[model samples]
Target: MSQSIHTETSLPIEREVQAAIQGQRALAAYLATRFETQRIQIFDERNEAHQIELPTSALRLLVDILAELADGNAVRVVPVHAELTTQEAADLLNVSRPHLVKLLEAGELPFHRTGKHRRVRFADLMHYKGERDRSSEQALAELARQAQELGMGYE
Candidate 1:
């Protein structure tokens, strides 16, 4: 559900916004028919959705989102970052800037110093994620095996 606007013609922007939110083919058709205005700038729903007037090229994006929603597809944006600043990297790793600097200092992981600041590669973050996932999987497997041996649940 999203709030709509009628800043342009006072015809009924809310109705159009409602159509977009519903994400049905009929709704999409209604929107296309109603708002002859072009260019809709859509942003990630993480914080807030701000509206901006876009050119006709943005129609493709609108169509994609509507189609995805209509097909019951989860609309999510994966931040496929290839590189990040020291602060961003620290945030990703859930570590403080100082601690990350310590890792860089200790030569534990490879990092590039950009002038006075440092940057971490996304590959390193991916590697760390894989290692953590493997550890979690191993722990879960062990727990399941232990439960089975102890006859914890009914067969």
Candidate 2:
């Protein structure tokens, strides 16, 4: 699998599509609650009908993706073990490519060189992101505590 599986750009969902997604999402969630797997029929452009079976987990994932689309958020599904280029990882982190490189060099995030190009595993990046987020939260909590102790008008 390649990281290029993601959409190149986020596009606005049309009203009709959004409405259909909402309806389908509701039905999928309902089915997920009642069954371990679902049989779905799909129609092609030629009006030919095809049926397939999907697990409850897939239905739940579909519901979540639909929910994000409904909320106008771009969603990218990256496999945990997938390798990402520096630019792709940077985009996921919402940071610049140079910043991501800095993190890789500083060992804040781990990456392996692929013929002079760096590749970061999606799982490692996510782990690093989680740790960074927790550290930030802790630092903010400490700052709040200090402010309260000093009577800095911060509750």
Which has the greatest lDDT? 2
lDDT of model 1 at residue 2? 37
Clashing pairs in 1: 39-54
lDDT of 1 by residue, 94-128 (tens): 88989888887897767887798888888886677
User: What Cα-based lDDT does every candidate model obtain?
Assistant: 0.65, 0.84
RMSD of candidate 2 to the truth, in angstroms, is: 3.2
Candidate 2 error regions (>4 Å): 1-9, 24-28, 31-35, 46-49
Please provide, for model 2 over 1-155, each residue's C-alpha lDDT reduced to its tens digit, 9 standing for 90 to 100.
44475565575468835874776666665763667888888899999999999897877777777776777677777779899999999998999999999999998898999999999999999998898889999999999999999999997
User: Candidate 2's C-alpha lDDT?
Assistant: 0.84
- Of candidate 2, the 10-residue stretch with the lowest lDDT total is 1-10
The estimated TM-scores of all candidates read: 0.41, 0.79
The TM-score measured for candidate 1 stands at 0.41
Model 2 TM-score on a 0 to 1 scale = 0.79
Range of the 10 consecutive residues with the lowest summed lDDT in candidate 1? 3-12
